[model samples]
Target: MSRFGPVKIVYSDRFLLHDTGGGDHPETAARLEVIWRSLKKGPLAGNIEILEPRQVDRGLLLSVHTEDYIFRFEEACLSGMEMLGHPDNRICYESYNVALLSAGASQTGIDFLEKGQAPSRVFCCIRPPGHHSEAALALGFCFLNNVAIAAKYWQQQYGRQRVFILDFDAHHGNGIQEIFDEDPDVFYVSIHEHPTFSFPGTGYEEDRGSGAGDGYTMNIALPPGSSDAEVLKAMEDKVAGAIEEFQPDCIIAAAGFDAHEYDDMSGLAYSTRLYGHIGRHLSAWADIYCDGRLVSILEGGYSLDALGPSVEIYLGGLCLEA
Candidate 1:
């Protein structure tokens, strides 16, 4: 009864090679481990497919990131620097390579969705999360703007212009907004905790993009302690109408789980079940606007115990419409 084809998860164990200095690092490799383990035994055990991701092509990486920045990042990792730009952006000698693989995961999904086969959702459960990364700067533990790169690939490779991105992470996707702020082709909408109380502090309602892309960027910030009700209301009232008018050819979700009450990474108090609602919203929207051609790239979700269950529930809801 799947509305689309089977759900595919683009992942690679080699992603674990990008060491984050280990210990209590929030962006640990264990994040992916738990999700992988949970999915194997979780309700959707037999219902999903797991596939390895190819390293992103250099051209694809250059589309969103600057040449100088990419080279600087590569040098930092190769030179044995413990971190890149900041303490949060930890790295290992192999991190540069691992990050490329992480960024490439979504493109592999896009390739599947673009094929003439029936449409299905792809979840890129990659690590060293990418939404926080800017073109030339690394912030909040992200090195490459994975979602933005995939959005670019969707347009360039498949000619699917007008890519719509929905980011529901607890923290706003500053990198994603900034990268495509002036590009009318990509519409970036984010629902995150207010900037006043969040890290990186960029997504604000007043900053509605610039130039020809003005009004394309929408930032909806829920106050602290926000729960499912506030989020769903905003989606129905604001997000949905804008997306309908945009009529995107493809959809990319910056799916983050730190907003869950248990995660404590954000003040927003979304429950684990809230993710399913989020997933259902994306699933319905994908079916309606993009023929179920939706891809979700992992963003932030650090709660060791909660991240796994939250992701499983989200994936289940993503496919529930079938």
Candidate 2:
């Protein structure tokens, strides 16, 4: 069966698009603006549902972040000072709330699929990516683990024995991997730059999950100069196999476009064309294993030139409905 089917693209008009804004910032409103324009011109725009990002209550955030960490993050946000990494990721208090709402969008999207209000393929276009953020700490450009929280949320509500998470960020999703490492219920797979040369450095093949969770976590650490062909090979050989075995109730993707060579921040050489391939592969896998259920959350991507087109290509492969 072809995984290609009706797809829902989720987004909000609120400041969710500007969680951490700055002049000439790599991740900025302009990125979403281009994506919006592109989608509007595409046939899929009619089927798209533009929903306002809802605030994820403290309880929901506490599902992945510690209470103390949450309090501090809230405090830092309220203080209107820079939080998380350098000023690049600094955010005002209101921006933090917006980030929370962006995360909340993921939860809402998952719920929509579970209820059959939409198709299995869902995309959340909100920003201030979360794969870099850990459970109790914020790093990179992320403040909260959006995809991780969504996976846990699904597990609790559906009581699913196993859930699969695929993170394709150019940089490793160290935070999510660490958070779910010991839990066998979540299978975490990532294909990223080797830890030796990348930030947050932790996706080594040897860093498999511990205890009963061993082998549930798979990492494909490619060297900095890896090309599109190598990346695609890793996905087909490694990621596809893992998903077949895990047989998850749902699939969540930490989708990042920074791996594109156009992105100055990453050294890996992938063209936007390759991302379409990734999207197509994910669509096929979702069709076979997860009842076509898939949720894709933005994680990272610095170059707008590449970022904008990459999203368009991915959506095309997703087969949005009329």
Candidate 3:
């Protein structure tokens, strides 16, 4: 059952059909389009605002990534070369701007929260998801750390002492964890499959925060066959419990649909209903602790059919009490 009501959803047509080097690309605009088109059939569709996508300036990216990294990423886009490890995830020349815009939508969502907008909740449906891209490398079809930069922006701009990042991606958000692993003020929590069999593999329970950031970073590695019930329990009992203790001013969700049973990427079996339940839980947490400031950034989910219904369930759950 859901508890929150009428969350203001924001999206862009640019996100719905942006081209990222086409042809079997995992992170294609069709992914966003399917979700958008499907959601329009539901009652929650009326509340969504499909706005034009905007560009993210280098200054905002500089906050989280080094200038060298950004330049290299742009060069890769221009050169039409796959990044070192991900030969298949490279973008075309035009894709550089698209990636930045997608990231900008995330930053804009944060901006809306800072401005005290209605719903005080935003979900960036654009991608080239940024959880796996490291400080310099653009792996996993990701270029910049969108959610990380937004979280850091909140901390720097609002003087938020504590920021909680709840990443539920099937794969660990290695880039985000790496960027804030040593920062006490930022708490990175992920409930992902153990990295051993996963790509970019690093989020272990023992990978807790370092030095001043100790005990703040927590990872709950689910086995490949973990079910939806386990996921809910981990969130309600473990993840939520930790957040309540930390009392963060804001919550950033690395909301990935890849765990969907129908998704091609991972073996985690979760129904769309479970994603709704998760979204509702996160919304409740935001209402109680963070003054309802929660921003969800899309990560990975390749199945078009599952992706649309999954997002619809999540947004509907956030907006309609059940």
Candidate 4:
């Protein structure tokens, strides 16, 4: 049904076990449930292949997070603590294991790509989203830094050294930026609502990478009312050039739909249709720069109504003929 081969969706039912107390928390198991139901019934249904995620190795987690912090997180969850370092990062007893599996989704995806698997485009529909998580702290409802760990695994395991991570979440991924800010090998790029108006508040146009990695970090901070035109303009005008210059060995997309106009998580006014364009642009970049080697990990997107459709549209664009 799709021009491209079936897109691999790396996921597992265990991700639902990471409970968030279920009251008014936007990031809940239902988030993944909505996405799964939508994908199964959407136009891309026939083009999707579901795969279970494997548990991530502790050494792989240590690649980005500190050993003490890792121990703290596990102890907190296992000891029946309601939350981690912050109240926003609500966790249940099973959250620690589920977070590991969430991080593992990306590694599983990378493995599929390196093995010359059927689908070149892989999307890890995981939750307990990881972009906002820092090495020593768990902020913004995230546990393990999923995308960051995946980038490290790709480099260490497969020797794909020059990795480019493009995060399009409503809130800046401070954790991701911090992890690779001083590393020249991994380039971290983010396009998010300006930190001045959003949470975790780190990304700024001038916050380029430090020493040895200067200019590797590119941040495009959009105003509160920014729309699809502005996002596309930024992509075409800035992101395109950066990707061309980097010529990365692989691209990891921190895909987030919270910027959608209907989603209350952010002030950005992006529409459901905008996600398709985002996917298309990323797909084209993958084709040109990395031999279609792209792994997209789910990030933010809280609107129950809009999130599902936005994800479906994004996958539709990724599967489109380049």
Candidate 5:
């Protein structure tokens, strides 16, 4: 096994303050709690370092979201508005600042990797989960496109122009794909449930990138009830080939666990162990092409019982060599 730097988890308790309004919301703060508790006591217990996020300037959000949208979302939260565009997007008074903190986790991670800090793997446990957030619209409980902003920040701030984003969320990242649909500098790749049978319904294999980014975007849609085998094949062959061809300078992962067999959010039936495999693949990829630089942002994963163990195993795979 190849050795690497320690793993750092950029997080803040304030992230839990972004309440999903009320009543059995799947995107609850408890998601972070369980994962936090598990990391403290599970197999990899005390093996990782958890750091609070930095004070990220709100203007950095403009790298991905429109200025009008940035102001509108903040106004809605502070003005006591219940939901933004959809009922699925329930918010509380603290959501605006909390979302900034969520996005800040990634910014903190970028600072470490870009500055050649000690940590090689940084995972941001954030909420108001992005990937569905658009330039000026909010969808699927997302407020800001966190991963997209990180990609832009890596490009504009640190000059890591070729950013390879691997999203293994149960649902396709419509907002992420749309944000970089025509930009070749950032490559967005996603593997999720077939749009015909999933929420938001956008990722189609035929929907290749347009214009300069003609072939950068790749959508690997799995049929309902598809299991780990299908996903592994796609990753080993298709995803590996794509990353090889692109040769990215950095790698970002939208790591969502809702695709697990125990989670009811999607029709896909992935086992908890599948996540470990994914982490190993991504870790190896980062080592090979990015000098062990990998930043993963959490997106979705509701089954509280399964989330802890799944995340732990994935983390184990991540720092396996370290």
Candidate 6:
């Protein structure tokens, strides 16, 4: 049994219904399937408890996304538009609802934590990955910003004002950063492939927060071909200090597995073992800084083969005893 008790997995079949017109699309239902299979058979198999997610209250969604954007997204999907603002954001009719549930997975996980329902650690396995989504626009196969909405909900519902978001996705979460950029209450830290060579073209190391939020946002830009050691180094050297100073009320991990060496989403080369290390670090930070309050929301990880094992190892690391 894991020292952390059963880690709750917030998910539902409805997540798979957000069909992205298949041909050559990296994000698909198969992604979650492989992950579920792997976890069922992997090291932490007996330590997980699965839970279905509740749809996000539209009011909660409006907390992060504009009403205009929400209306536009729903209209586009119902009107038979194949994509949203950008072609990369492929969508079908059911996508709008699925996206709301995806965002809600985080809220559900937080509810479990705050209410002392299950374990301190929870993972939201639903997706149309949210990091790339903006408040008013969709990009990089994302619609609703899951982690961001969770942070907002946590603040409003539980009064946990200081939220620390650690994003280790290969691509920058421009949406999350932009939403909380000027807000001192939520600190956004991202370690991603250098924007010069990656998508969305943001997350430069120099772009700290603005005004009252200055020095809150930290972007660690990794060069192409970067590997596990580099990621760990950034966590220990940079992220650790930031978390120490911020002393957030909760830590939200924008957990993305695409940085694995085999995943072709980005040029960075990270091993599957690296995910375990990342999980370990996050777990330790949670215990130290936030009363073991750590919630991980799925982001990007395309390679079907690597995605499964990567997630397995990550959860395994989180379940490990101190």
TM-scores of all predicted structures? 0.98, 0.92, 0.92, 0.98, 0.97, 0.98
Q: Per-residue alpha-carbon lDDT of model 4 for 197-251, expressed as tens digits?
A: 9987889999999999999999999999999999999999999999899999999
> lDDT of candidate 3?
0.78
Per-model clash counts, in order, read 0, 1, 1, 0, 0, 0
| lDDT string, candidate 6, 37-87, tens digits | 998887777778887898888898999999999999999999999999777
> Deviation in angstroms for 236 in model 4?
0.5
Clashing pairs in 3: 6-319
Candidate 1 deviant stretches above 4 angstroms: 1-5
Put the candidates in lDDT order, highest first.
4, 6, 1, 5, 2, 3
Cα misplacement distance, residue 37 of candidate 6 (Å): 1.4
lDDT of 2 by residue, 11-33 (tens): 77774445455666677766777
TM-score attained by model 1: 0.98
Candidate 1 — worst ten consecutive residues by lDDT sum? 1-10
Flag regions of model 6 displaced more than 4 Å. none
lDDT of every model, 2 decimals? 0.90, 0.78, 0.78, 0.91, 0.88, 0.91
Q: After aligning candidate 1 to the native by TM-score, how far in Å is the CA of 249 from where it should be?
A: 0.5
After superposition, which runs of candidate 2 have C-alpha atoms over 4 Å from their true positions? 1-6, 16-21, 85-88, 117-120, 320-322
> For residues 264-320, could you state the per-residue lDDT of candidate 3 as single tens digits?
788788888998888888888888898878889888888988999998888765655
